[model samples]
Target: MQRIRAFRARSTPDRPAPLRRAAAPAVAALALLLPATLSGCAAFGGERSGIVVTTNILGDITRSVVGDEADVTVLMQPNANPHSFGVSAQQAAELEEAELLVYNGLGLEEGVLRNVEAAEQAGTPSLEVAAGIDPLDFAEGESAGQPDPHFWTDPVRTGEAVDLIADAIVEQVGGIDEDRVRASADEYRGEVEALHAEAEERFAALPEERRKLVTDHHVFGYLADRYGFEVIGAVVPSGTTLASPSSADLKSLSDAVRDAGVPAVFADSAQPDRLTRVMAEEADLEIEVVPLFTESLTGEDGDAPTYLDMARYNTGAIADALAE
Candidate 1:
């Protein structure tokens, strides 16, 4: 039997401060003031109304589909972990007032899901992108049977999401030309298809033995299933970044890494690579730690500023790490 020793949880960069009882009155005052201020801005043409997206990846996709018809406001910052990123009170209010709210559902956005639910209850039309796709279940451990929310890893599935998001934008958002939205979506779909083809070609070039992945977390299941790669194990055994890895989990993964002779362990660009480094050292192997844009997009000057760029960058990184 493996001994499971709990590791201390690391603080996420975007973790918000705790609400205090004494500050409740000030918070309530700000809550009341924000709407009126936002309303005034809208009246003065300072605020652009359109789609409000919870995650940066979905925000980029929505931007591609909408194409300046309406402004798209993304709540999460570039390279922030979606599972832990929280929105501001003003952003939450914007979610309520936006023409449509788009989120990567299936419990991926743990911190912001409550705001999404509130927006829905307030009668703002919303779309859960993962709800339209055939989601994969957790194949093992404590989160078994829950739907995997990282469907965007699969380009074909992401293309499906493009169509679904386009349709929703056309139907729900007023003042946008439906024909233009459809046309934009069609063009983007072709791009997605091309991306998928490129990825397939790159992945096919790798030898069968090299198509194995060990990662910081279980984030690549969809990509592995789509590209013929095997995810032997992850440093964190669960889908979400919020889950902590036990010492036994790390030891087991290290043993697997040694047995499989994996050349590299991949970590998300938005996350700390400490666990993966430790795992590699513990395995007593000369394994490299590669960073990939697995979850969120980055700043405009960054490598993965868009959905297409993110996929291309990730695919290339994976191939280079494994093929070498």
Candidate 2:
């Protein structure tokens, strides 16, 4: 078990010098124009109710735990990439006024972390869900040794996160029924455990030799670790989609896929799978490129509309793709 840090509702450290310098002018301009822009648009007029979440996955989980106790406003839209999705100025302001802000901290929401930090600086308590869960480190490449932010890939870890998130909501969000929130958390955790068991059983049916995963990026360290799959390689070889794959990286990944006889290369449905496609072509093998809901949830009508749906869909897809 990873050492769980006590949850702190404090501001994060200042942005790097270069980023601060680059943002200073924009910050100044926004400061000058914000008041007028906000006034005309009523950006700050509405009653700021409920918990604000930075990512859709966390938003869905928070909603489950909070139930009708509080309105949960998720900043990231359905089928969006957390690393690169930016919040609007109005949404940023809303974060500052929210009862509590929940984010997947460990550098997952690169685009929104600054806004979360700003919200914390303005006195809104922020919860980093990853802080409470034992996080996996990247096994190799540039991201090795860094805490993996994609803990939701492991259902067991996510079940633990439900406990942490429920506690935070009960303790931080005022006027909520503590008993109700705790009950909801327990209920959700049971569901998560069931999901974990089902996924484990499905994966267990897969032959050990066939339990190899090659993805668009290194997004499945936890999933592979939990289910006994070997991560053959990834096109980008990094944790975040923001990183691009070099020619050498692509070549190596293509070779690995061919060598491992991987039947499918999985990519995030929220992202363009161009790189994965290109790698498939480069490998010159009859391999399938399967898209999974790895990073974000889709709209309500789509396949992965909720957290549990996303996990189940991905698990079934993996089983179908690899257990052949």
TM-scores of all candidate predictions against the true structure: 0.84, 0.85
Give the Cα lDDT of each candidate.
0.79, 0.80
Q: Show the lowest summed lDDT stretch of 10 residues, model 1.
A: 35-44
Encode model 1's per-residue lDDT on 215-311: one tens digit a residue: 8888888999998888899898998888889999999999999999999999998789999899999999899999999999999999999999999
Measured over all alpha carbons after superposition, the RMSD of each candidate to the real structure, in angstroms, is: 11.6, 9.4
Model 1, position 17: C-alpha lDDT score: 16
Q: Which stretches of candidate 1 lie over 4 Å from their true place?
A: 1-49
Going through the candidates in order, what is the number of backbone clashes in each? 0, 0
Q: Mind giving the per-residue lDDT tens digits that candidate 2 earns over 1-324?
A: 221111123333421110111123444353343211110011132333578889999999999998999889999999888889998999999887876778888889899887876775554556677755767778976787777889999999999889878867765677789999999999999999999999999999999999999988889999999999999988888998889989998999899888999999999987888989999999999998898999999998999999999999999999999977
Best by TM-score: 2
Compared with the true structure, model 1 gives a TM-score of 0.84
In terms of lDDT, model 2 sits at 0.80
